[model samples]
Target: MEERLPGADRLPVGRRPSEGLRLPAPDRALSSRTGYTRGTWLAVADHLLDSLGPWFTPSGAQVRLPGRGSWSGADCDGLEGYARSFLLAAFRIAATEGDDRLVERYTRGLIAGAAGEWPRLTPCSQQMVEAAAIAVGLHESRAWLWDRLDGPDQQKVVDWLSGFVGSKTWDNNWRLFQVVGEQFLASVGAPYSQDDIDSGLDRIEDWYVGDGWYTDGDGQNFDHYIGWAMHLYPGLWTRMAGTAADERLTVYGDRLRRFLEDAVHLVGADGAPVHQGRSLCYRMAAAAPYWMGMLLDASPLTPGQTRRLCSGMLRHFVDHGVPDERGLLSLGWHHHFLPVTQSYSGPGSPYWASKGFLGLLLPAEHPVWTDREEALPIDEDDQVRAMPAPGFLLQGTRHDGIVRLLNHGSDHAAPGEGEPPADHHYDRLAYSSRTGPELTADRIDNHVALVGPDGTSQRGRIRRIAVDGRRAASWWKVGASRIEVASVVLGRVEVRCVLVDGPGGVTIRHGGYAIADQQRPEATTAGTWAQTVRTDRLTSVVVGLHGYDEAGVRLGLDTNAFGPHSATPYLVRREHPGGPVLLVSAVVLSGDTVWPEALAEAIEVEVDGLRCVIRMAGGPEEAEEVVMDGGGTPAAAGETS
Candidate 1:
């Protein structure tokens, strides 16, 4: 008995009562873990498409969904609604052989849009972004939608799409839009610039730093875009080009295979993607590359593992009330937490998650659908992996089903003078599957800064020094002061060491993970340790192992995507006698109860001049030692348990 948007009952085609998404019953036989079958995917697609019935304009050229418009304004937002949803509808129609109602609905929109109902595409405009989605939809549903259009309407469509020819785009992933759109034009015998397409493809080569990693554009800008946009578009472009793409296909495929090898370790046992990076409002779109892997047969993961990973991701959001009661994807994470969205995130922007539905393109008999679900890396045992390309250290614990990312690189900073201020999403020292960085005033979660008269120093432009096994190191500047940080991850804890080379009397602050929930989290500070525990028993703890003199918790309201109430544990060194001072802290986030004093007791720290050594005692295993020099460079003497 969900409420429908205006004009829902007036639709002439596949309209149904608005009861939210009507998913199929769990098919445990096929999907033993997530219970999401191909039928489940189809049902969700139809439900999403049908829910849009009330939003379309009379001419069907635009879909004006109810929500705040993006900075691009309402005109671009309307086109976004139509084009993004059209992509979803196209996926459904193509997979089902032909959904007559869907084909007709989107076809009408296309014709009306081609007849000038939609806005003209312009250089570096949001319209150019939607044009790529429209081009892909038309290419995928050519037989039913594109081919059936009258010759005049087809010409009009070509004229509209031709805007991509010789047009400039932002140097990032937007380049791929022109590549795909012009390639689609070429497929239809329309005018296209091979140079435009080739240049876009070639531009990404400059950003690819091997190990299957691409920097989005430049300057260590790594995030989910690496999966959803960077890899997804090239794979789809190759599919659209067919035999002509064979050479590039092999190259892109190899890179994708290597990327997936590292990506498989990023997801938690509960299927949550590590909450890092920007544009996170596109929730499950992180799975697009995994689906692309299956599409191009370019993945090292087995069919069972691939399905498990994708299904787990989709179900993770669905279970968390992603679509809400209205069956609409909002510009937020689990709920309407706007901090997770960017200025370009309109109501329909989340539908770019449609790319995740790429799996539906495979035949029903494909092993990805038929194979039984398998466990992810986190479901088996604890894992610690280093991705040097992005300078990330991934640590996953099997007991708690949590995955933590110790980020030594990927700050989203451009390479030049006057870099933009540090963003909470990219500048945090750590991110995890279960916790989000605090975004409220005086943000402190997973950060280290020197509090000065001007303000807290920003961790500007991370310069990575090393990312080796179980350890990573990086250095950044706080005005004239130089700050070096190294992390050694073990089990559920990360030993963070910092070296400060600044003037004296300024306080140094270090923060732990931010835990959030519906209710105010339980927080405590005693002696040299601080802790915050959510209602669900998710815990965050920080202990002052050295240099820090005080510990406390920072409270936030509506500043996190995971919940409305959040708390972060932090330690502060008061009146630091700072020139080249060394500080050490143990940071932990887990589902189990942790005693900060006991944890501090278990970890023994010894410092002689600038060189520091840390030995962490394991319950049943031997102690692990990490040695660090003056610059906070860590060399582990033993393996992580």
Candidate 2:
């Protein structure tokens, strides 16, 4: 009875051996009769575990910045999540390479890092899955050094980690971490009460969402956190412990596979996943699915594809940027800038990407071994897909799997919208287009509270649904009159809109880039009725938006990256009060292949009309200017006549 480590976790930090460590042959499913190069695994793992990885210190278990800033200590809660990556990597390497030395170094490293009596008495504050991973790693390894440690030392590790199981803050990630850690420790002869483990399991059930998802906290919990920490730990822990009664753990893996299957198609031929959320600080964590694939026999992904996906994902970040100037994972993408991370995200978090090692869990002869790597589905052809993520319609398409993303959601609460806000933002109905690194983070300007999926509703959080089909819908704070660019594939283009009430019925139409007359939409409504609209194939589109900001109102258009195949271009009209209302324009990709712009040419101010008609051709430019139109009802009262 022990926690399971993969074939690569065991290794010393900072230096690499002249020859890489030798890993054992994977079970046939992972490769053919011939074992693959164990050193390849060693090099990759070593590079990750080396001191270049997260820096742990004696004074405090801090994730150090390489150059600037003081070595900040992990808030007690954040400490274990930080160490988990190192320990998981160490244990994983030992499993694969049969390197007992590697396991000993890290096990001792954990004990040394735990240092004094503080850890034994205080569980990590966050109660996150990260620390649980480390606990499980060591419990499983029962590594060379475990027997050598004084009873007090080993007890310190268990007590520190186990203590988290019963804390009140055992909030979301905290309990999740407890479940995995406790499961692992109990498996390895540690005396965590079965009652505690069962209770922890019950608490986790409280947050489970169907389709393989669980929100770490209340509201719409959507992001890599689900993949990396939540379902990830539960799935791995149950597998390691062979816990059959933990239906939630088994279900978590199945659901995770569903999410990965539904999602893997979105990554283009190059393996670039869409980036959305915090600790993107942990860059490659998105690829953690590849490891899960190895852990579960029912995976939809192929081994070669897993290898390609993980390897490609790894190289993408490392090539683009993972470590900043100091050899430590930086705080931001392209540079150091994120000031909003929970203490847990320090440099060490990214290696949780080691979940990638799940790929090593395979038996060597698997087809992932024999099958030639196929180009990812996204890179293979042109298609449209819709998924419910974060919140909104996530439509993805690709040209031979070259990626294209169309974000049809509200941008009401980006960074600066709340205390920590988001790490990325763009002003006008932001939607990220990606060919390489994570792009959604680029949009960080919504000025409202950006809580989870249920954050918007009266429930005061984002609404979510669990597998039992129990429904929950919290109207997360949303940008009124919000708009998003959905998909731009090859020569075809499409943008979607979900309009809430706004100044003058949330008008949108095109002007400068308008094509000659063709069938155009008369209106867009939340009602089931699809307004009168048509589409004309054009090489470019000009979608404009006009809404009110806190300051009176603002006018803008989603028309900057102007091209049929490029990210949709949107520009806001700069407005000053005064002047007879002029013209407004909008661009639409009507159901048909043909498209034509509808223009509103009226120039009068109607004081109380909540609904403003966007007359076809020459209609007023749908003003993005926020005018308190008609009792907050954007339909009648304050329409400009």
Candidate 3:
């Protein structure tokens, strides 16, 4: 390729040249041919770099000083990596522009940050926390961050990263990120202990559920982080670590091929991954696995699909309005979902968006670059995958181009189990319909979705539940797919779901609230909690929130009668074998704008033993079944920046 522009050789990073550098603004620009074209991803990288430049101080750490919006929580944690990423984008873009100053500046800043943090990273820093941050400081060779560092700064970063080998034993998501980040550093010959590397890999190996998925930590509710971080990071590690790690890396690479094959469907026509678990702050980085597809040559995904998938994500967020005014990235989608980020996510973190740069390492001639467009699984109208190893099935379906899940193999309640505590962010039923588990709900024991005693997410609790006198194991279903979980002590919960196919159409079903356990105490009516979703004449609703019950007198019984007083919608298990309160009373998806009279006419409720069937009024011959486990407005409320 012919090169142009004099300064493209290296980046000159003082501050971005021009502000508000908007490109032609991708407005439904479809390539007649491929996934991501030769320079499309590079353009994305450039756009991101240009868009985020304002967030970094010339010094390069992302404090977001006073006017920009005070940095807080995980939001602060994201700055380092994002600033570092400008170098990577600069590297890919520099070769074409012949101006490489951005590359040199970012690399220098990384070295400077390492030197600054060298004396401070305490023995007690969260293992994964520091590992993920400093690991980038180690490898990431594009703009030559290491080459620009003075000998001492280089040694400090290398030594600091190496010291992390035995610090904390990483498990689940932490281990997943640590291993992959370290592996990338190691792959590039950056300092990292072989023991730390092996131990991390060993831990991950234990959680690999066949059919291409890994459990976050060791619990239930593992979702997108696995696809984005777990499967993608190892390749970077093995590639950089030295050929000795190839065998293990290849094994991971192979399994990931299947996982990618299995997971590519999680993204719908709009490129949204069902948001499930924590640290959702990464947003669109969920598409990182496709980069792995380019890296590991994972099949069943063509260049067209890759390009479309990545671009679709870009469009989805941009359509939702990303890239805050100062050209900096901000949190929130539809405005209200902004808290989707964590304190760990400082301004620099959004650069994990560089995962989109997966194609950078691939030359212009590879098959990934040449392969023609093919429909991705998520692009399929209806798709299904069975996993015997995990003993569950994953199904993908689309309505209004929105993909959602219906989980049957999972159980939310256990025998004699009391309701979990209250949490500000945990939406109990969102997991049932999200493409992936939504994190960021302030968990307990670092688990993604579990609501612990303290009202924070806790480690997962999965075991067999006896239903109708027989023991039954369970799993997690984010959208149409199901992941077999560990055996749990559970009671009978028969959940049935029906898919309604129409623009903005939804399914509806009634919970068996008439059971003897649904008698509400007269005194608890005013304090109950409620979350509501508007679907048409039938507003999907939730109520009867019981925080904690102790003996006959409940310890925490909040009450409210605001939404759907007669039929509640929050709790999926409104009526159980032995409980005395029905939270989620009735669930039916009605029209938001245009209610198909058929939809209203097609709806009918039928009682069957402990199971209640919600049948559409449509002709019995053509009507479908609806599973109305209470809970409305599935909140995967996040988007990639």
Please list the C-alpha lDDT of all candidates, in the order they appear. Answer: 0.85, 0.42, 0.42
Q: After superposition, how far is residue 572 of candidate 3 from its true place, in Å?
A: 12
Instruction: Please report how far candidate 1 places residue 6 from its true position, in Å.
Output: 28
Residue 68 in candidate 1, Cα distance off native in Å = 1.5
lDDT of 3: 0.42
Assess the local accuracy of residue 249 in candidate 3 as a C-alpha lDDT between 0 and 100.
Answer: 67
Q: How would you encode candidate 3's per-residue C-alpha lDDT over 1-641 as one tens digit per residue?
A: 32222122221222222234243423233443222355555654565566655545566644342222324334334344443464345446433533355656555555655556323333334434535644543354434444556677667656656545556644555664456555655654666666766787788887786667776554333556677667766766665566777688668778888887766755656666554445554556777788777767665577777767765665454433344434444443311133455544554555555555555666667655555555666465545444333233344444333343222222222223332233222322322222222222332110112222334223222221221111122322322222221111111111222111111111122221110011231111222222222221322222211221110111111121111112222222211223111111222221132222333233454443222344433224432332222222132212110
| Comparison by lDDT, 1 against 3, better one | 1
Candidate 2 segments whose C-alpha is farther than 4 A from its true place: 1-41, 53-82, 114-124, 127-130, 143-153, 244-250, 324-327, 339-344, 363-371, 389-392, 400-492, 498-500, 503-569, 573-641
lDDT of model number 2: 0.42
Q: What local lDDT does model 2 show for residue 318?
A: 42
Model 2 residue 118 lDDT score: 33
Question: For model 3, what is the alpha-carbon lDDT of residue 583?
Answer: 16
Query: Judged by TM-score, which candidate is best?
Result: 1
